[model samples]
Target: MEVFEKINYLISEKNLSKKEFADKFLSLNPRLRTTGEAPSYSSIYGYLSGRREIKIELIPYIAEALNVKEQELFNFDLEYSTEFNIRYSKDAREIIELLQYAPKNMIEHIKATLQKFKKSYEDGVKEPTSS
Candidate 1:
């Protein structure tokens, strides 16, 4: 899968229309475009339709705007492909290293905690509990 395919998959998985996704992205990163706001519809359409490629320098901002890790922007296969030579940031690299050492049970526990935390936070609760 290429970057465009991955992005399309993510967009569909999230059940977001292009305009809604763009709006949410802008909400996350108000400084994404030179206008200090989200990209216009045409810009998004151009990128998604392959008329314009997503620039390397804008990858971080796009990932942040989408509330995803920068590495997630690339297709998983691309990450393993010899042709793809992107470098991870120090923090992201450390996280990848840590994941290698993490136990399955630990990863599951963290996932559960994160789910609970997200729910609680969205509900404006104080904290999440195991139960």
Candidate 2:
């Protein structure tokens, strides 16, 4: 049977055994396998085994149920640029949420730190101009 190693990785990272995860979903939504509104036990097993492709509709729901960002489900390559972008997206979201209630002093510190980091990055990439 085919298997996407990435799926297994994500499952493990979410601290869920395959059975536990599937059971949780089925438990949360009883109409799943019984009513054909969702995948059956075999189908979820197929996804875990890589014998089936995970449908796009389930991505967000699975991520939410698993308590992680959707990016965690599909991104297996840590070295890929997409990985960096996804992480940045998650981090930015978290920062924005936290900033909503941040004290003035903390907000100022964060802003100053970000500005310094941005300036340093720019300086590092600048080329010398000829007179």
TM, every model: 0.49, 0.49
**Model 2 residue pairs with clashes:** none
lDDT of 1 by residue, 27-66 (tens): 6553444455556668777776767776565677667656
Name the weakest run of 10 consecutive residues (lDDT summed) in model 1.
83-92
TM for candidate 2 is 0.49
Worst 10 residues of 2 by lDDT: 78-87
Mind giving the per-residue lDDT tens digits that candidate 2 earns over 1-131?
Answer: 11246556556755789998788756556334335587888988887787788766666666766776777666544523452544354456467768989999999988887777667657884433322
Off by over 4 Å in 2: 1-4, 30-36, 79-131
Scored by CA lDDT, what does every candidate get? 0.65, 0.65
